[model samples]
Target: MRTLAERAGVSSATISLALRGHPRISAATRRRILRLAEQLGYRPDPSIAKLMLHLRTRRPPGFQSLLAALTTVPEAEEQPYLRELRRSAQARAEALGYGLTVLRVAADAARRPDLERMLRARGVDGILLLPMAAPREFRPLLDWRKFSVVSATNAVLAPQFHRVVPHQFSNALLLCEELTRRGYRRLGLVMNSRHDLTVGHGPSAAVVWQNMLGGTERVMPLIFDPAGAGDLREWFERERPDAIIAEGADNAQDIARQLGLRVPGPVGFVTTNRSGPSVFAGIEERPDEIGAAAIRLLTSLIQHGEKGIPKVPTVTMVAGAWVEGRSVRAPSRAAPRKAATA
Candidate 1:
């Protein structure tokens, strides 16, 4: 500060105000001071900058405020996975000296009265969106310019808010390689198209790409409607794959039984998420970690007063951990018997 002020022929106080772009400093003086600082390579330390910001925004005790986890999904408490995300987010918010609340806003306008008003009334300035099973556009009547917001799902297509999610692409590729290492070939991927699109088709695309890289006969992915479970068995029978990768636990179990196959005995099975205790080897999405990261990002945005859709939206991916379960095994190496002489 002293050196720059001397070079710019100004007092240290004038240099500080000019560099900070305080309104009291004339524009010409601000430009001059900035140019001098640049020439001197006088960059402010980030720690000092953050301390100065904290001093400026310091609130008296008891003024510490609330943030919100906004959701459109009903009966969120009944869903243990959603509960885990909320719990993790709340814990992180508390750790950052802010209280967090979960607010369920109905999708229907009749039931969802002015969400913006509700938020402003409670003085909530930051919002964390929970993951949804299906993609939905956020057509809020509220003024989005007033608050910092982020989503934990790709389901929010409108406004393209920043997101934090599982690394579906790499995770799927890793799973396929792991399955191959276990001596399982003829891998089949089955998932609902809607759900696949909701996650940006990374998992499904990875499966196909991996199969293509193997330089063998291409196996088609079996995409089925999740609401229609009856066809699952039919697809399994038709594909006759040595192993299957799916997202639903019940559907996988049912298809395995219909084929008269025991998991890891005759055929192998893998699930995409560890939503519950199961005998299937799968990936753990770790919603808790994702939730914590969302809070961390949201807090930074709130502190910076960044609101509305970001010009450069970012998607932060958390890699899922693989869980080894009793659902896969090494492929049979028995030689094919010679065809009977005809």
Candidate 2:
């Protein structure tokens, strides 16, 4: 430490802070100290450092042991995505031999006391944040260097932390290509307005559909509120799309029938997620693979004692399968063009 300080022409404290990658250290000084440490072959003993801090503060045993803190906010009802994420995380943690602790914060817990207290206590070594309707600002309350954290969902708007999300872009492109190969052209997409393009699969699917169709195909964006079934039916009737891609297969079929459209014989449909039933051609989304990947990433950070922005923030995406259901039909062969009359 003293050598690094002298070589970098900075205080020993500055050297220490820089080695820990403290945000308070000036960027120039941090860079110099890091370069010096590398040249001098200096490496801090993480275990000893933790022990010394505990000894000075009289903290509890296992203060440095790894703990994955899973957190979610209270909602009216548990969302299907969140439920699947929770199940996958717990199962992965058990397989990896790590302790998992879940913390539920109230809707307004961002400004509350309990959350701050838990952070100060160092209750966990890292956090896996689940998706929520409302954003939470808990990063400022904790020492990021002491813990590693990553958000399981793309709900983190700022991209302030590491994330593992579905590869919606590529997945959507694949789906579009498959549909084209299966002899369907006029494609339509139905999605909620509030769905995040980066986090959710809907937007990517839309972009891919547009690009794949170019100027030759008709693409419709049907935004419907579940509360207004009448508006939904009206849009379907007016558009009269040949094939529809929706989040809900059953609901889409019902709406299609209400519009006097026949499924599998005339109008066809596909689903983005095969969550409830495999009643239509759909993408699997592979939520379980996403869950397992998040665990692997978090554990890697813990095992290596890595903290703050990973050297390489991994964006792991799993592909969804194309399951054929009774909702898609082979396009009718166009009538042979009659030879021009002589």
Candidate 3:
């Protein structure tokens, strides 16, 4: 400050105000001081800058008082994994000296009020939006410009905002390779048709891509629709995959039981998205970690006052951790013999 002021023939106070673009400094003097500072390569120390910012804002650091989660509450049987996300997010927010409020809006509701107004009324300047099974209405349902919004789901495809989620594609690819390396020849993917949208189709795509990279063995994915189980057994028999990968371990086990197949005896089971520690071998999506990370990003956004959807939205992907469980087994010498037709 003194060096720049001396170079520009001004007091250090004038140099400071001019560099900060304070209107009190005359335009010409401000420009001259700014030019001198640039020539001197002056950069404010971050600690000093933060201290000055606190003084100017007349508020303590962490000015963001509260944050809210705007969610389209799903039907009772919907994604139960989201429950863990909210719990973990709330815990993380409190740890960071911020408050987290979950505001629910039913997906089937007829009247969708001004969500932003309600949020503002609650004094929330930041948001963590957990989109419903179908986020088609995410745009029309909320005012994007009023808050620093971050999504915890990759399913929020339209009118994009910054998001944090698991590395679904890589997780799937890793699962396939792991199974194959263990001697499973034909690998199968069974999951809800709607779930394809949830992880952004990363698992589905990765499975297909891995299949393409393999030898002759291949199994077409069975996209399960709850309305109709739709030949899950027939698909399993036809594919005769040595291993099965489903959304969760429970789904895989149930499907195997229904098919009268011996799990890990002939056919191994693994889950692509494990909710938590389990007896299933596969990737742990770690919704808790993802939730914590989302809060961290949201706090940074709020601190910077980055309200509104970013022009180039960012996605922070947390890699899924491989959890060894009893569901999978050693490499298969050959796929189980094909089942007989009716």
Which model is ahead, 2 or 3, in terms of TM-score? Answer: 3
Span of 10 residues, lowest total lDDT, candidate 1: 333-342
Model 1 bad stretches (over 4 Å): 1-63, 76-78, 108-113, 215-217, 227-230, 257-260, 330-342
In candidate 2 the C-alpha lDDT for residue 166 amounts to: 61
Worst 10 residues of 3 by lDDT: 333-342
For all predicted structures, in order, the TM-scores are 0.77, 0.66, 0.77
Clashes of 3: 3
Q: How far is candidate 2 from the true structure (C-alpha RMSD, Å)?
A: 10.0
* Residue runs of model 2 more than 4 Å from their true location after superposition: 1-76, 79-81, 107-109, 119-122, 134-146, 196-216, 224-230, 250-265, 308-314, 330-342
Across 241-317, the per-residue lDDT of candidate 1 in tens digits comes to: 88888875775787677777787676789987766788888888888999999998997777545778899999999
Instruction: Give lDDT tens digits, candidate 3, residues 1-342.
Output: 888877888788887777665535655776677677778889988899889877866753353368988676644744656888888999888876688887777664334457656777888878897746554546666666878889998666666899998888888877877787677778888888777877888889888877777452767988877667568878877888878888886787788788887655667788987776676788877888889999989977765557788999999988876777777875456643222111
Q: On residues 1-342, what C-alpha lDDT tens digit does candidate 2 reach at each position?
A: 888888877788887767665445655666677777898999888998898666745733222334554445554566665678777887777665556766665544344445545764755656776765554455544455656777776655543677776666655554555566566666667766545333455444554455455332765567655445536666666766566776656656776776676666676777766564566877777777777778778866654456775666666666666666788864245522222110
Candidate 1 pairs with clashing backbones: none
* Whole-model lDDT per candidate: 0.76, 0.63, 0.76
